[model samples]
Target: MGSGKRSDYLPEDERGASFAQIPTSFGHELRACLRCRLVKTYDQFRESGCENCPFLDMEKEHDNVVNCTTPNFNGIISVMDPARSWAARWLRIGKFIPGCYTLAVSEELPEEYQNICADNNVLYVPPKRT
Candidate 1:
């Protein structure tokens, strides 16, 4: 958190949470979580995994990161307050940690990963494509 401006938006307890850094500039390196749509750089995903979908255990797992994230996403929405932000609620990320998220992810989580979600009792809702 390091007293950064972004940490100011987070509650005191969550200021130290390990969410992805906001992309300085969008590019091919960016990827979105298939489950929560949290946006992060490919390297970031390898290093930190998805803050919202820790069950994926993507950190340091190349294949897991590849299978659980996608570069094909549209729009980025930064949510500072999940509980109160109308946009976060509309996007169905009200329970996710504060961070940059995709408006829509173009790909689906693999079937095996979907089963993992089920085993964990996490509902896996495919992103609406329109």
Candidate 2:
């Protein structure tokens, strides 16, 4: 997850097998694995289903790394209607409709987006959409 020239560090044998889900200027690479908390996207981490996941860090957390899902990320919660909004009433999503999720991930990303994807830093903190 470092010095790989970034682009959200996908290349764990191309996680999510080449992404492009059509959600705007840069809004969905969704990841939240901080030690297998599991919230993968980007075509479900390249269809290998996040193989050897070991909490891969697609970024947006900090404190170095430890199984890495960016320490249970704390930024994306974009539920639209798991049944009727209200933030999906504690979403446990099986199949989604409106997207962008990951909130109760066990806690970490608070220190200014932690490091914002340090080594492979592509820098997108609140900077995706145009």
Candidate 3:
């Protein structure tokens, strides 16, 4: 009688492998300006959060701005600088947020990113308090 062959359920090499490697060059280690969409590497940043962006010279949009839940809110407020210029030149107005700025929170934020919020003025409202 012929003996039936037993199948190996798991791959020999994959059984102990940790995981796949993340791509190195997908991004250039650069941060893009949220307003003018300028991409600058870490070395080019003027300050911790500020950079010299081409769009910084462009106009701004001040009405109905959006922010996030931050202890400081300054980072978000700095973002509004561009929008304020946009409103003044195009809309011919001032005071972007007569109403409260819209705040949105993601599932989780990186520690550095969270620090940006912590050093700025923002009202953070979580769905549920921990």
Please report, in order, the local distance difference test score of every candidate based on alpha carbons: 0.79, 0.40, 0.25
Q: Report the lDDT of model 2 for residue 6.
A: 38
The digit string of per-residue lDDT tens for model 3 on 26-113 reads 2444333332222333333322222221112111321101121122211111223333565322421122212111122222333443
lDDT of 1 by residue, 31-103 (tens): 9999889999988888877777777889867799999999988899998888799998888887677889999
What ranges in model 2 sit over 4 Å off?
Answer: 1-32, 35-66, 69-101, 109-116, 123-130
Candidate 3: regions farther than 4 A off: 1-29, 33-38, 46-108, 122-130
Task: Tell me the alpha-carbon RMSD of every candidate.
Answer: 7.5, 12.3, 23.2
Tens digits of per-residue lDDT, candidate 2, 1-130, equal: 4555634333445443222232233344555543223455544443433332313343322332323443235556555444476554544432233445555565443443335344334332331222
Residue pairs with backbone overlap in model 2: 16-45, 16-46, 17-46, 34-69
Better of 2 and 3 by TM-score: 2
Clashes of 3: 10
Worst 10 residues of 3 by lDDT: 62-71
Candidate number of the best lDDT: 1
Please, what's the RMSD in Å of model 2? 12.3
